[model samples]
Target: MKSTVEHLSPTRVRINVEVPFDELKPDFDRAYKKIAQQVRIPGFRPGKAPARILEARIGRGPVLDEVVNNAIPAKYQEAVVSSEDVKPISQPDIEVTEIADGERLAFTAEVDVRPEIELPELEGLAVEVDETEVTEEQVTEQLDQLRARFGTLSGVERAAQTGDFVQIDLSAAVDGKEIEEATTTGFSYEVGQGGLIDGIDEALEGMSADEEKTFTSKLVAGEYAERDAEITVKVTAVKERHLPDADDEFAQLASEFDTLEELQENLRERLGQSKRMEQATQARDRLLDKLVEGAEVPLPESVVQGEVDNRLHDAVHAFDHDEERFAEFLAAQDKTREQFDTESREEAEKAVRYRLVLDALADREEISVNDQELTERILYQAQQYGMAPEQFVQQIQQAGQIPAIYQDVRRSKALINAVRSVSVTLPGGEAVDLSDLLGPEDDAEADEAPDTVEGEVTGESAESTESAESGADTADSTEGTAADAKA
Candidate 1:
């Protein structure tokens, strides 16, 4: 067997492979066995017929076809392994060139490959991030949140206000027909959360106990989604949260702190730490933007198209692949299919470029994802999807998505490495020390920093806490922050 590679472009290659007849004996045997099991012979038992006898019965062309079909994939893999530099990122476009009887088989495969990237110097890159400033007001807000957690609700005799909690019965009718899924009784909602139906807050604000109001709002979900519905909300009870006074007793009740002053100080320190973490997140995102913007990465068209197709498939899947419903959804968003296509293409290209940049950086830095890191990422993802780790692992393995997860973890680490190497400064040009947020290794060489820190400080650590606490979308957060820096 022999193989040769042709560089079609910076990010693609064509591999031509030839396998002599002697090398395909195993493939031929397997093909014969498979064919024999499907066909019956007059004298031989099932799957017990000799290869020559089977070939005589099925003809040489069918046997050869079976052998070629079974042999190509394995041979292609061998060809890839033999060529040390040919790393394909997409499925190959294979064409069998020749299959001479009793001679040799030849084929060519064209595929997208990782491009050679000329990376910029990591240490010399400089980026600016917001300074970590935990204001007194922020500390107060945190304390207020703590107090709210321990607050009690008492019935009120007045109209509902913005901060009031209310118990109400809701019913909706679209085109004079009641929507079953949109009706609920004895529902508790905060006055200004705005999550239930649109215009519910306005209707509730001025209503007192036992008062009913009807308002028209668009149903955002269920069968009547995007349709205007006449909603009748009847206020059963009005209540307001009565927070405890910020005193030593209240502090003792709310936390382990013996004094309110100590609780305030602790809250301030925690807020400072959170702000520093935010600074680190901003630095990570900005550094990634700088690296991607400064580098010249040739995107693979096939990979980008694959990503776009996946996104489109997911989008249409939510509407059960009904094209008309999808079109209606776009219309509701005030967007056309053309606009969605353009935006999806742009997003796909950006995502591909990001992955490419990080992969190149990972190679340059010799970054590797170990078993522990991979497991940790898998567990985290399982938690995100509300599945057990074992179940999640099984699902991903069956779906062949483990490699994608590994790649995401690798890219995340690569971006973190770039963040640590880059110089991060405040608006006033003062260099900010992110050692506390980025872990001690990030500042190990600094004269004033400690020798070591426990734990890794990557974007995952910074974003994971925020995502878990606020249920923030990690992709949207990163994209928004990166776009802000770019702008």
Candidate 2:
């Protein structure tokens, strides 16, 4: 067997392979055995017929076809493995070029390959992050949050207000016909949370206990979705949260701290830590933007198209593949199919570019994910999806997505390395020290460090409170590639 590679482009290649007949004996044997089991012979038991007898019955063409089909994939894999520099990122388009009776077989495969990238100096990269500042008001807000957590609800003899919680009965009717799914009694809701049907807050405000008010709002879900319905809400009880006084007794009750001043100081310290984490997050994102801007990456068209197809398929799947309903959804968003396609293409291209850049960086830096790091990421993702780790692992394995997870973890480590190397400064030109927040770069500690999604450092202790909300912009701005790719 022999193989040769032709460079089709910076990000693609064509491999031509030739396998002599002697090398395909095993493949031929397997093909014959497989076909024998499918075809019946007059004198031989099932799967026990001689190859020549089967060939005589079914013809040599069918046998050769089966052999070629079975041989191509394994040969292609061998050719790929033999070529040290050919890193295919997409499935190959294969064509059998020639077959000479039993002498030799030849084929060619064209595929998207990982491109060669010229990496910028990691240490030379510079970025600016927001300076960490914990104001007195921020500390007070944190303290107030703690106080509210221990607060008791007191029944108020007045109208419902923004901070008040109310017990109410809600019933909705569309065209004077009641919708059972939309009707509930004794529902407890905060006055201004706005999650319960739209315009509920307006109807609840200024309504005293035992007061009933009817208002019309659009039902966003259930059978009455997008239809205007008359909702009648009867407030049975109105209660305001009464926070304990901020003194020694309150401090002792709320925390391990025995004095109010100590509690306030602790709150301030926590707030400061949060701000610092925010600063680190901002730095990480800015550093990534800088790195991507500095590097010139060639995106593989096939990979980008594959990603776009996956996204488009997922979108249409939500409407059960009904194009008309999808079009309606687009129209509701004030967008056309053309516009959506255009945006999806752009996003796909950007995502591919981002992945290619970080992948090349990982290769150049020799960044690798070990078993423990991979397992930790898998565990974290399982928790995110509310699945048991074993179940999640089984599902991922069945889907052949273990490699994708490994790639995500590798890319995350690469990006973290990049972040650590970059020069991060504050707006006032002061060099910010993130050593305390990011921790040391020892392998044992890095393996234990919380994994980042995409290119952002996330789930650090300081950022835990705001992790769900704060990283959203970074994730969205990057088009979810950071998290998806473990960037």
TM-score, each model? 0.89, 0.89
How many angstroms is residue 195 displaced in model 2 relative to the true structure, after the best TM-score fit? 3.0
Clashes of 2: 3
Candidate 2 least-lDDT 10 residues: 467-476
Clashes of each: 0, 3
Per-residue lDDT of model 2, residues 1-487, tens digit only: 9999999999889999999999999988999999999998998999999988998899999989998998898888888878988877776889999999779999999988778888788877788988678889988998899998998998989999998999999999999999999989999988998887889999999999899999998776765565678999999999998999999999999999999999999998887777787777677667666767888888878777776776688788776777886786788778999999999888767666777777787788888778887797777777767899999889877755556656666766777777788888888888988877666663534534453223223222211111111111110112121223312
lDDT at 308 for candidate 2? Answer: 76
Q: Compared to the true structure, candidate 2 yields what TM-score?
A: 0.89
**Candidate 1 residue-wise lDDT, 183-202, digit = tens:** 89999988998878889898
True-structure lDDT of candidate 1: 0.74
